[model samples]
Target: MTPLTLQTPEEHPFAQFVRILGKGKRGARALTREEAREAMGMLLDGRVEDTQLGAFLMLLRHKEESPEELAGFTEALRERLRAPALAVDIDWPSYAGKKRHLPWFLLAAKCLAASGLKVFMHGGGAHTAGRLYTEQLLGPLGIPLCRDWAQAEHALANGGLAFMPLGDWAPALQRMIDLRNTLGLRSPIHSLARILNPLGARLGLQSIFHPGYQAVHREASQLLGDTAIVIKGDGGEIEANPDSPCHLYGTAAGLNWDEEWPALAAQRHVKPATLEPEQLLEVWRGEAEDSYGEKAVLATLALALRGLGRAREAAFAEAAALWQGRDRAAL
Candidate 1:
């Protein structure tokens, strides 16, 4: 008979998940979907210790994340989101601020709104420098940034377009996103935030800087049972560069697909000038002649239109027409 040993009850419930990922190279392994969900659930519940939280995140960062992990984490996160009582046609996330160009995608979203498509856009910035954020541009451009779900509903009902900051919609995750500065590295939250889709919109448009993330986003969206378009948009914002082939990954009605849209321009233009919110307004008004900018806007809109179920030819034609026929005075 052996003396009974108390096997130090498994560390903290959350620590078990951390140890699963941080175990040595040969011993460590990616968390299963359920494990990932439980880990994120613990983090969101504020039960994870701070020290463990950092170590867990860094361990994940070191190994990167699998699509299964993203799906689990995202599923856990969406559980905490509070959506407005309204219909949204597109779930547009704008996390990466524009650094190389003005946010041409904003104009595209406005174009969609002008065409009666309700666009629910959400994002965060300030973790990076010298970039123009959608929240900052929307206000001065006269578009409203919603302070809460009720305000988002009002904006959608009356204006057809609404913007929500991450901090307002999901403060817990926003707190994690904000940690980018302190950690000196982006955690998996960066990728997870783009797919939040809080409103349960039918279509989600996501952008990632890294090309590999394209597949990760596609798989995660499929797991969430939502349709989404993931692109390596210009400067990691949702705006596409018409001068380069745009790689697209998405699922529609349960069918997953990938395609490459040919570039619209022969030559890539140099960065025009310091991006200005007023410039966005000017282009929208048709008072500015930016061939590159206009093509970028229309091309980006075409992707959105296509994602929303318009035929390829029809989407492209409709996108160009909408850009040309937009209500310039609305902004």
Candidate 2:
């Protein structure tokens, strides 16, 4: 009897999610919100196998994540975050590193922080080549790099700004991001991380490089009951390109709207031959002049202001004032 016994391998619990997405062309469809939440929770909890994780991520990359999926993934992440009860006004996520220009949006965040707004900025490491990441420049910019929730709390409570690496708070998400090299393509974690707003900030600022993702982010923000702005920003960062008209998609007070911001320059500015991190310091220290850089900073600042409930004209004006009045020696 023992020699004649036979057994079948038991199916993995996480296999169902992979099957949901890889069920052939017609049979496959997007995961529902509840399914997304369950799958993300399983991944974040380390319940998913490595093979299953890779396949699931690639499946999502092929179809792109929907608003419901994004919202659900964000909800799962928020449930596991060790974030403090901080009065953060702005949630600034920097994932797409700068390629053509210096990160002018970093200055925009600094200006907001200097003006007494609690700005919580988070980003992953430089996983890709030839791009300037936020964490790389935070030290040079004099922004506090928080490694944990306690440090982040202290930094925001005292200096009104904090930059935390993704790995510190969400190691699973960071691990997924690091898979970019192994997978040879970016996964949906990049998009999911953008709208995290982990501390429940009043305003979330998101940037997308791919066309059509702006609407996804805006709608996902609405689903999450978060006030947020989405833009096709400079180099896929939340920095406005002063050389072109910027279109904004966002939700506020339970209403969605769109606005077009006119170009700040008549002629498109040429990208710098090379990016110099020190230039950020030079411009902030009042030791150098960069017309394009300054305009980009101001325009990005205006975008954040608008997301925070300021009107168009007033937001631009206030952004300029904030720049002009910034303590030159603060950095």
Candidate 3:
């Protein structure tokens, strides 16, 4: 073998993005909108080394992303998404699995679907334990789960509702989402996924556990030119809790606003013993009397209908009327 000459390798194109955030306090700062867009693009393109990727993600988590950074990162991911064949009326993202209660939001989506709104719901599960995931409840509820864009379209055509797991739409982001188990902390991927809205739906629904992320999502949605509603949902999973007050943020026709909804159930609330999927169906079919669960379903549906452009003045009454008239046979 011939003697080999040693050569200095050029730095990775993605290193500077990490360094920009990790530099000393005097020099380090959040990325501009453009830098964030560029960084996310490089990341999704698989140009960053594993070490650099981890560093960048951790830095973002520690700093909590700015509105600009969120907007840029979301825009980058949105650009890479394979567009669906058809438009959905609502983009419901359920990344935060329910820890304290069952996913009441699943029923909310089904309710919307039954009412003729094509709801496209997406999420991932098993990142954390002792939580109920949206995907797990889809089958029993008779809602179809779409594994790819084609199936998503099929499901929509069949039932007017489709649940797409994040891994199916954005495997790269799913890989990042899985890092939670290794990093022992939540990353910005969680926030970015909620705002993805890959299908460019007319209305987007999101929920956040941390109160501060409400405005981050609101501002980012405005940047994406999406009409959305972000709420402090029950267990942070996009379902209104009849037992507690609800805080909401949203954008309508490009105008941003916030609203406060009082609790529908004022008495003490207790979770069910089984937390089974059947309970959701039971409530929807009018076979079980869960006053709280029913109230939560209607209230959540009302918020969603208003977000989808019903007159705000009559949305709640219309929602209650709709709920009262739902075809039990659909269950």
Of candidates 3 and 1, the better by lDDT:
1
Q: Write the per-residue lDDT of candidate 3 for residues 1-331, one digit (tens) a residue.
A: 9999999999888888888898988888999999999999998888888888889999999888988999899888878887755878998888888766677777777778877889998987678888888877776888888889999898887788998899888888899989998888988998888888888888989888787989888988888788999988887688888888888798977789888888887685887766776777887788888777788887888889889777655878888877887888887
CA lDDT, every model vs. true structure: 0.86, 0.93, 0.84
Cand. 1 TM to true fold: 0.95
lDDT by residue for model 2 (139-188), tens: 87889999999999999989899999999999999999999999999999
lDDT of 1 by residue, 1-331 (tens): 9999887656777878888998898999999988888899889989988898889888998998888898899888877666645789999998888788888888888888878989999887667888878877877666778989999998888878999888887887888888888899988888888887888888999998896988888988898789999999998888889989998898977789988899999988888767767777787887878878899998999999989988778989999899889888877
Candidates in order, TM-scores: namely: 0.95, 0.98, 0.94
- Displacement of the residue 247 alpha carbon in candidate 3, Å: 1.8
Best by TM-score: 2
After superposition, candidate 3 runs with Cα above 4 Å error: 1-9
Q: List the residue pairs that clash in candidate 2.
A: none
Superposition error at 218 for model 2 (Å): 0.8
- Least well predicted 10-residue stretch by lDDT in candidate 1: 77-86
Regarding TM-score, does 2 or 3 come out ahead? 2
